[model samples]
Target: MPFILTRITRDGLSRLMAKYVVGQIVCHERGWMDTHMKQIKKDCIGWHTFHSFRSLDQLTVGVMGLGKIGLTTAKVLKGFGCRVHGLVRTPRSHSSVEPFVDQLWHGREGLADFLKDCDYLVNLMPSTPLTHGLLGDEVLTGASRRPVIVNVGRGDIITEADLLKALEQGWIFAAVLDCYEKEPIPEDSFLWTHPRVVMTPHNSYNNNEDYKRHHIQTEFIVNFENFLAGQPLTGEVDWQTGY
Candidate 1:
């Protein structure tokens, strides 16, 4: 699996970034901790309504790419009693995640339906020619529940302009993006101070402890040894599919 940057949308010039790995180092559920605290801080010592905070049990989470990492995220959401739906290229009876997802959708045809009633939509889709600019005004505006958009996937999959438009029009509740169509996202970008958006510097795939754990290095060495022995590698990349 690899992460790639195809073309710069706003800047018209060509710039690229690449990564080769099957797993992500980011476990942003930790960042959700800070988000919750920030929300509380914003509320201040104001009078509290009994229903000010919605319980996790009342929410439904939709994951856009139900691969290995997505499945792991679904498990966490399930633990919160959320009804989790996953969007996959194909819904398989034998998929390890089938048991975790309450519903499944396939391809672009299934995207609108998947966003229909979700309280939160998590994007984990890989970048490819087919997926570039996939989540734009039409898709966000179609979301019936006005769900919060959380993007930890490739940035080019969604456009910042469309996202801003969607937010301004109340097409979506808010957005939390760990990556962007252009990164080291331009300092002048309004997203830096946008009330409806939370931006992080493309660090979703980084963790200080990851290296200490030998998580990636160990896996690479083992796979290399397997290759030397003519055994199966941990992952395979199909240039056409781009996964």
Candidate 2:
């Protein structure tokens, strides 16, 4: 038997994650969570004095990692009239992402400068040695604007301890996390009770078994047909890149 893998849901997952990121930003900026809690606890209503609230178009969003998902996220944000910036480890030739971003920062040397200009920092990078702890003190401290950190990527990019310190030190405003250093986060984890944090199980991608099975079968059939026709397949993973 031969093993086959397909990323038939990559685009859908990216769009879903983008929506989550935008929703978190709106919730944080508009104080929706706090207001909801107060309404439930104190029976308060009509308390809508939000000093820090701002529209999405007024914010500058920085996206780390400009792969397929990152590019999709950027495109969605751009559609909302946001000033989007993208970061990559190296430069690409004639990249499709260029038209979606207002600025592009290349290499680690520019990370600090990039962080300084962002009102929201979205992380969509993969798990690799170079990306481990990449969002710790050194990089986060450069966020002079105190951007809200949104991590829909691998959790190991920033240590939980460092994330708390960054929040306490005022390096970043808050965090919206879908992934964590540990899954199902420990019962005693500070993140569970942190007021400035929002946690979600690693479900940015839809996990409906029926929907997934349908897509997988469709992708496989399409690829099999293409193979028979001596045509290229979609989502051919490169082992060396580990995508």
Candidate 3:
């Protein structure tokens, strides 16, 4: 059988994930959900108790792995008047993300500096040798801002034990996790009950099955045409880089 390499177009998915990140930042970092829940339960209606909440415009956000999803997230945050920062494996000239990012960091050498002052750190990196367990004690400890962790990336990017320690030790504020080191997260996991955690079962990319199938078929048709025309195919994987 002949194989035709293809992938679901990320434009729509990237936009959706970007919006999800913003929603997570607003609800988790600013304590909106907690406040709302309290009001619904008739626990408290006073505004003073929630005065600590900050506006999105006042935040400084850092995005790791400035790929399609990361770039989209940064752009959406910038639209809310945030000072956006981005981390990439290497530098690029005239990149699409340049306009949105106030500051950019290149490679692991600059990771510490990139994370230091961020009010929110969004992770969108893939699972790779360079990224596995990249956000452990050393990296988390360097964040002076005690940033809220927003991870929609591969879960292994963070060490679960170290993340728990960071929260316990106050190295970070809270977390909005859509992915985890383990699927189904085990019945005995602390993350399920952690006061500062808001988690989802990796549902960020979910959509109607029919809708997804339509897009996948469209992508395949486009790639097939490109192949016949001897044109560069979209979503071509770089085996060496493992993206």
Candidate 4:
């Protein structure tokens, strides 16, 4: 061990103030933790704990899309302690989901600023013709601060190249990927090597299989009632949007 090590201490900021170091390491003369409190705070990030930012006080969380899961996740986070915002197309409708979002933004350029203050970015956008490769460099460009990204939606929404660039270039702080451009991410893939990245098969929103019969019966009952009433069927497919 080098005795030439330099130990510096100051009181500009308290250790309890940091998000990473949760409380102080208490020292006990017997089996001691060697606890000593001095203000030498560097910076706290990705800290989740009792005294960490996990409690969500003063935390900004942004959801990229306002779909079922997205809206639910935002609301759940708010119940805990975070300020939740949503990115939806402009002129959103009034709903319980709206109240959950502290703010809303629309379009790609809007995303840049919408995510500026966010500590966590939850992407729930569906993969469509326009949304294929949406999270490319143009959108990830100039992000003021890196935020932890959790992608529970379609993978094609974010391109393989763009996701690679985002990680290597530090556009996003870290990622929790449950889907990908390729289902079987190649053994040679960059995502496998990236230390800050987490990967999983697309299974976050597992369908309720036990309700399969109920779902079928429910749909049939509604449509059957409409048929009996001689009314137009609901859930007409949108050929143009291919929904």
Best by the TM-score measure: 3
Candidate 3: clashing pairs of residues:
none
Query: lDDT of candidate 1?
Result: 0.68
Candidate 1 Cα misplacement greater than 4 A, ranges? 1-51, 94-96, 210-213
| Global lDDT of model 2 | 0.83
Compared with the true structure, model 4 gives a TM-score of 0.66
Question: Which residues of candidate 4, in runs, are more than 4 Å off?
Answer: 1-53, 93-97, 207-237
Better of 2 and 4 by lDDT: 2
Taking the tens digit of each residue's C-alpha lDDT, what string does model 4 give over 1-243?
322111111211111112111111111111121111112232234122123223455567787777555666666667656788778654565464667788888766577778778767777776667567767765776566676677766788777788778878888777777778887888888888677676656655333565534554566677668778977665544444433
lDDT of each: 0.68, 0.83, 0.84, 0.60
TM-score against truth, every candidate? 0.77, 0.87, 0.89, 0.66
User: Candidate 2: lDDT of 122?
Assistant: 94
Candidate 2 root-mean-square deviation in Å: 2.9
Query: Where's the lowest-lDDT run of ten residues in candidate 2?
Result: 1-10
Candidate 3: residue 239 Cα off by (Å): 1.5
Q: Which stretches of candidate 2 lie over 4 Å from their true place?
A: 1-5, 45-52, 93-95, 207-216, 224-232
Report the candidate with higher TM-score, 3 versus 4.
3
Among all windows of ten consecutive residues in candidate 3, which has the lowest summed lDDT? Answer: 1-10
Give the per-residue lDDT of model 2 (tens digit) for 149-189.
99998999899999999999899889999999988799999
Candidate 2 positional error at 139, Å: 1.7
